[model samples]
Target: MLRKIESKNMGSSNLGWLRSKFHFSFAEYYNPDNINFGVLRVINDDLIQSNTGFDTHPHRDMEIVSYVIDGELTHGDSMGNKNTITRGHVQYMSAGTGVYHSEHNLGEDTARLLQIWIYPDKKGYEPNYGDYRFNWKDRENKWLHMVSSKDGDAPIKINQDVNIYSLELRKGEEISFPVKEGRQAYLVQIEGNSLINEIELNERDGMEIVEEDILIKGKETSHILILEMSKED
Candidate 1:
């Protein structure tokens, strides 16, 4: 089954320094019926103004992954890790026991990113942080697997039974993904326009796929992100 979620219908917040669209209950966007999708907790499409960002905040028992879409995002965490990443890059933080971190857009322009949160298989694991600077051409018209369990081959490992992939499809090109039995996935139309399994999706749109397969065609050069996990909520 496939369900398309238009961007216009999603919950949104507009602070002067940070504008965000919430895919799940977050901050002021609370909905008891829409708390999460499986273990996927949150996906916040955020735009941070220059020289401003989130101050140090604490988190625990959550696997956080931030995907940089444009401009630059600088990260500093309690683990003594500090780094800056730009478009097409990924930053990961596993807040097991607990951790504090800050995200800022210190660049000259606004920064766009997807802040994703997933529940771990079990709690009390060790906290960690990592980032990847991927090659743009790797995801050009192809799926670039980026995140997975520790046993999997993705560059970044998370404490969950999940797999994450990305693609930057050229205009008019086609691609496909399989959501195997007992598994589900969420697809984000991050940039540009796309038609997936006959559903038209514009920028910032999302789709939920369960125990099925999907074929995506680019109406324009589209940047896409997908997170696949077990079917159980």
Candidate 2:
């Protein structure tokens, strides 16, 4: 089954300095029926204006992943890690026991990022943080394996039964992804537009695929991210 969700239907907020679109029930946009997709809990599309960003915040028992789409995202955490990452870069933080972090856009242009939260396999893990500045050409017209479970071979490891793949497919390019039995996947159209199995999706749109293989054709130069995990059956 393929379920498409329009970008407009998702929860959104704009506080002048910060603009966000919440993929699942979060903060001031709670939806009891739309809480989550399996263990994948949240996907927040955020755009922070220049010279502003999120201040120190607390999180615990959640695996967080932030993917930068444009501009610069500066990150600071209690673990003594402070770094600024740009387009195509990713940051991972396992707020197992607890942690405090801040995300700021210190550049001139507005910074855009997708902040994702997934429930960890189990709680009370040692808080840790890591990130990867991926090469821009690596995902061109192909899938780039970014994050995976501890047993999987991705550069970034997290405490979950999930795998994340990214693609910067050129216009007219076609690709295929297989969702095996007993597993499901969530596709995030971060930029551009595309048609997945003939279902049209514009920028910021999302889809849920359950145990089905999908063929994607780029309607435009598309930036796509897919997270595959065990089915919630």
Best by lDDT: 2
Steric clash pairs (candidate 1) = none
**TM-score, per-candidate, Cα-based:** 0.99, 0.99
- Candidate 1 stretches with Cα past 4 Å from truth are none
Return the TM-score for candidate 2, rounded to 2 decimals: 0.99
RMSD of each: 0.7, 0.6
lDDT (Cα, tens digit) per residue for candidate 2, span 1-233: 99999999999998999999999998899999999999999999999999999999999999999999999999999999999999999999999999999999999999999999999999999999999999989999999999999999999999999999999999999999999999999999999999999999999999999999999999999999999999997
The number of clashing residue pairs in model 1 is 0
RMSD of 2: 0.6
